[model samples]
Every structure is written in structure tokens, then in C-alpha cells.
Target: MTPEIVEISFKGNKRVPYFNPKEIKVKPGDWVIVEAEKGIDLGQVNKVGRLVALFEIKGDPKNIIRRAVDEDLAKLKENRKEEALAFTVAREKIKKHNLNMKLVDVEYQFDRN
Candidate 1:
């Protein structure tokens, strides 16, 4: 029997499998809150069921904390705004110092921890 796992996609094209111990009903394109290294994170559901089993899971998957709530979504939006501001600031600083670097993307952790 295959384990109940759901693939979640985060920023920076990062994807990871998370264990759905509670069997929370979720489908692709759904937003979910999941366990992060520190507090928690929000990601979009990419795949579920047998398709997820095809991927070689290396370690015990983290738990899907819950389906994203309204509060979580609000936080995500605020984080995006902060990320944009941070990106602009970083680009200005880099140009100020004339460093040979290119700014790509800026992301913020859900909990900001």
C-alpha cells in the first residue's frame, strides 16, 4: 500500500512531499499550510495520491499542518509585499557598491522567523 503523501510547491520552484496523516481532503491548486524547518509554511498543492508515490521520497515527509486559512492567506500576501520591498532595497545596495551580481528573487518565510 502506498502512503498518503501530497506534493506541495513553494517559491523558488521548490517541491516537497508531505505526509497527510489526517487525510485532509486536498486537490491540485489548493493552498495548504505545512510544517517548516522552524514554524510553518504555506504552499500550493501540486500532486497527490499514486502520482506522488512515483517520486523517490528520501526522508520521512513533513506533515501537512492544515489547509491554508484566511489568516494564512493574508499573511502570504503581506510577505509578498515585504519580499518586493526587500528585493528593491537589495538591488539598490548592490548597484550602489557596483558588485558584479544579479538580483533574482526574494522570498519570505511564512512565519518570518
Candidate 2:
């Protein structure tokens, strides 16, 4: 049988495709752990189903590492909070400096640098 395909959303409006081994059940909006370039990262399942082909995707699909655990969820929440706080601070600074450019988005890097 062919493995099912799943698309998950990552940070910065990025979506990646992964292969579902059919071991764990995941649906849309479900948080899952997926293999990353450096380490495992969290992903929210956006789409799932068998696909004959996809557009502009390179290489084979990866497997879902596992469903995200409580700690993972908590960490995700914390990161989001930090992102919001940073955005607020940056906006305040921009206003103080009277910058005309509009702030679009902010992304928190895992390196913690």
C-alpha cells in the first residue's frame, strides 16, 4: 500500500510535506513532531491524504516523528508569547523613531541568540 501524504505548517508561513507511515493518526489542526534539519520541530497538520503529485515540492516526503507532547505544546505557546512581546517592543521603538515603514511579521529563531 502507498503511504499517505501530509502537509504541515511551520514557522514563517512555511509548509512542508511528510509521509504518514500510518502508525499515528493525525488530522488537520493536530500538532505533531516532525524531523527538522537540525532537530525535531513542532508542526501543525494542515492537510493529509493520498496525493498522486504535488506542485513545486522537491525530494521525497519525510515521516512524522510523533505526535507533539504536552511539553512541546507548552514550548510552542511560550515561543508565541515571546514573539508577541518582541513585536510589541519593536513596534513601540518604530513609533518612537517615527519610521514610516510598516512592520510585517516577526519570527523567533530556535538558536536563542
The numbered model that scores best in lDDT is: 1
Model 2, span 38-77: residue lDDT tens: 6667889988775424555589777788898898888888
Q: Residues 22-96, candidate 1: write the lDDT tens digits.
A: 889999999999999898899999999889989899988999988998999999999999999999999999999
Cα distance off (Å), candidate 1, residue 46: 0.8
- TM-score for all models, in order of appearance: 0.90, 0.67
Best by TM-score: 1
Error of 2 at 45 (Å): 0.9
Give the CA lDDT, 0 to 100, for residue 4 in model 2.
76
- The 10 consecutive residues of candidate 1 with the worst lDDT sum are 1-10
